[model samples]
Target: MQLAQLLIFLILFPLIAAFFLFLAKRDLDRAWIVKLSALTIGIVSVYLLISTYDKGGLMVSGIPAEPTGMIMFILEMLIALAILYLGIVHKKWLVVALIIIQSAVMLYFELVYAHAIHVQSNLFIDEFSNILALIIGIIGSLICVYSLGYMKFFHEHHPEMPDRRPWFFAVMFVFIAAMFGLVFSNNLLWVYFFWEVTTLCSFLLIGYTKTEEATNNAFLALWMNLLGGIAFAVAIVYLAMFGNGIMGLDELLASGKIIALIPAALIGFAGLTKAAQLPFSSWLVGAMVAPTPVSALLHSSTMVKAGVYIIVRLAPIFQSTFTGYLIAMVGALTFLIASGIAISQSNAKRVLAYSTIANLGLIVACAGIGTYEAIWAAILLIVFHAISKSLLFLSVGTVEHRIKSREIDDMNGLIVRMPKIAAMMVIGMAGMFLAPFGMLISKWAAIRAFMDAPYGFVFVIILVFGSAMTLFFWAKWMGKIIAVTSDGKNIEGEVDHSEWAALVSLAGLSLITTLVFPLLSTKLLEPFLMENYGHVAQLSQDNIIIMMMMLMLLVILPLSILIPTRKHRHVSPYMSGRTTTHDMRFSGSLGVQKKTVLSSYYLTEYFGEMKLKTAGIWLCSALIGIMFVATALQGVIL
Candidate 1:
């Protein structure tokens, strides 16, 4: 009962808080309500995870007895209407067209055909749901706490701007609530409802700042996600009509039809858009214009995770189909492209954003690989990436606030000005680098998963190349941050208490999560895999020991580098045959000094937004078109 109530609280609390928050928007004193509400949700989340430990499977609610096909048809009509309203308000005709077509399809499913309903299960709490709930509850809570600090600075930065904290925090919290609903739901239609709610919440949050740029980016996000939503609605409607009108995920999974591969791939396409896989990657990058905490919460910990979560959950059905190869190709391409682009970026935030897309691409690729080890790798990546990426974003925000810039060149010698925050940044960066850490552990697993597959060697090649690119981009940024003057003085900076709190908390969490990984694997992850996939394999004890030893060596070796740096006299960087002065300026012949500026090579000729947008849009459209044709062909082929 506590678990049931915990689930209820997780869903309803944020909704109730959103109403009250909107009501209290005019008063500054009500700001504390945001923090209080998030804390309550967090507490409930922890309680739910704990209560479910000794419990195996708990059903919270029963589905309505009405025929699910009729029910889905009705719900879809309402969704279409809601979307039409959005289109009219936003003046987006493309959304209007999309909704109209989806409505037409639903009409046919409802009136032209009749299908029998089958009832199997209602609401459920399995180990997978529990783990996702923990992620949403724990990491989502931390993001909220971090937001309190971040939003405060944001308001100070834009003092003349209208106060929108209520709407912002309300939407952010509701997003968390919706995610809880999504993962916990056994009813496919119920999950779909929650899914649409998340789409709405993300649309609102992405446009939180309401600048022209913010609104435009938000619209792009809206349209792209709507494309996915349409695909989801179509899949749900088909399942309701033909496959026993059940609309419960467990029933669908057990139905045993290759035709289900159609929806699986379509769902994966949705994940791609939401995960910001290349081609659709711009929406997440554009999302960076919002305040820092939103970026941290949405991109790092929550919204993006939802995309891959759906894909990973559906992996069993699609693994043996041609759709699997298609998915692997999409993921591998996204990984390679994003990593290559990240190499050319000078903006620290852009680097992080592209890296996120790249990592998510790798996760999606692992899901396509679909071995037990592959699924394990994907889940591990989700956890560790959440920790380190959120820390890095928050730290960067604090640094930008102090230094008045987001460029890496401006951050040179940051260790001199704000040593503690800089150290946190370095730690976060190192944690993300794919070697001797959680991220690397997952990458290695992914490589093995791909290599074991028949005719999957190409994916392995792409994965390896992407890994090298990732290393280069991250190392370049780290080196730039610590680059110093010939005289050896550190760069100077300062930050407030709120900034310090967020940075320290996230940094500490990243390290702690890594330490407890073995426990997480055995108790939380393995059970879920065994329940779903069957036949769990134990990781070699020797491999685990080697990783631990490597980590210990990192601790000892870094100390040596630090010790020598403090004692040795600093000297100028090597310059070719020219005696130079003024740090990065070298004397040319005849008394002229040439300034040597350090900036990343942003291969605009290849990866620039202007150069690639047209081609990407065309390819995305073509890929989506092929998906629809293939989905319809399922009926004919099977």
Candidate 2:
């Protein structure tokens, strides 16, 4: 098939499948349909990549420039109206004010500023695009597969409700389609359109359960993203006015015209919102209230990626701006803050959510650095984090399903009840936590990048401290699960076949990828970086050896089973020198024992929602204002 057609198919296959699957309803087996759809999308994505391999890039001519812009304008107005209606209905004065101001700004910019906007390359593919496509396809497909198993169990647990699997899968497909569109779009306008589509999908998906918390979280997500959409719209309008028909990404980068830092800062602001940087990070953390699969797919793999993908794409354009330095600071700070908070959470999912935010923050910081090395690190981090994190979440979900809880304390001896899943968790955790794994290597790259930057010294401190905190929490969790027991009956391992299939595939992937890390770095990732980022670093043998040694100390050698180890005697957790048989509770006066429950040390009094909301809103608003002021000033000067 032709490459353009293949690209279209890759973008549309899931959506089309979704429609059919939704309509099929009770007549179809939902798992089969979801798996089939996922497979088809993955296959098409692979074909598209192969076809576009040697070709520089391709553009499609079917969508006209002028009409696309007009359509986008109308869509923006419609979405704004919908949000306005929501705000009015919910009596959220803040949402109303934000939306109205954004709407007015967009209207004025479109009417007064937009000039000739033309892009010859409509559908361009590059090494970065290929990497994104691979991630979206492969990781996304695995998430879909895992969801098949997950949703079945979910419905079984909540059997009273009408099955919404059809609608859920349908929206998921559309979400993936939008992601593909976003990555392949050369034109900023098209990218924005896809960006809004993802926002819509996330809103729908987050609210799928229709519980009060789900609905509220979904709205929060919507409002936060609407803020981003506003920034993006503003950037688009200004770029069109002064940019003089330069909308294609390659053309914009080549122009080398550094307008005021703030417009691009606005663009970066939009990215932070989407990436869930710092104060905006709560939405992603709250998203854990939704289905585990959604968390695995959106937070771990695809939607969040869209945010950093934009930052990386625009890295060169914003490379020399003060806003650029600020972007790096924001990202590093986010990494530090989010990781600090993650250490306080014992809710397994919340810990994963915070960890996700921290990792993405690192990726964003790397992109903000805008160096060849940092960009490479960002991309590699994306690749590894997606796989490892998704696997971890899925495994956790399975464990939660069996144990009926997500608390780390409840999972103290998880290795005994669910050995296979626990083993997978260990591997996944190692991939994320251990050295020589891609995440640590990428982080190492980030530190090197930060050290090279004159102004990012503070960021290095934050990064180092934050990383240590992350290790602490993950280690605590890991140690608890593998806590030794003298009883021979401690190990009881049994799990469903469907669950095993998904878990084993992901776990195997985590291990095999690490074993072949050198090849992956040298072959696929390094070549792609050279082609796209224009500079290359030696994948030094010494560096790899050092990482390998660290991996031995942190994960590999410790985990390698030697001489069928006997179980150690179980002992009560240390508590003020008291000993008791009860796992959590301790003996009191006269041997009268009181159950002592452990909950995560949520430092709400300090970092609570109420404490942070006002500050977050104020800071983001100020940032938005700075963007506009800078843009207006640049406009007057130019």
TM-score of each predicted structure versus truth: 0.89, 0.88
What is the C-alpha lDDT profile of model 1 across 227-280, one tens digit per residue? Answer: 777777678676765655746677666766454676667677878888887678
Which pairs, if any, clash in model 2? none
Instruction: Name the weakest run of 10 consecutive residues (lDDT summed) in model 1.
Output: 485-494
Stretches of candidate 1 exceeding 4 Å from the true structure: 24-31, 54-58, 61-83, 100-120, 486-494, 555-586, 593-596, 603-635
Pairs with backbone N, CA or C atoms under 3 Å apart (clashes), candidate 1: 416-490, 416-491, 417-491, 417-492, 417-493
RMSD of each: 3.6, 3.8
Global lDDT scores for all candidate models? 0.74, 0.75
Question: What lDDT score is found at residue 375 in candidate 1?
Answer: 88
TM-score of 1: 0.89
Q: How much is the lDDT of residue 601 in candidate 2?
A: 49
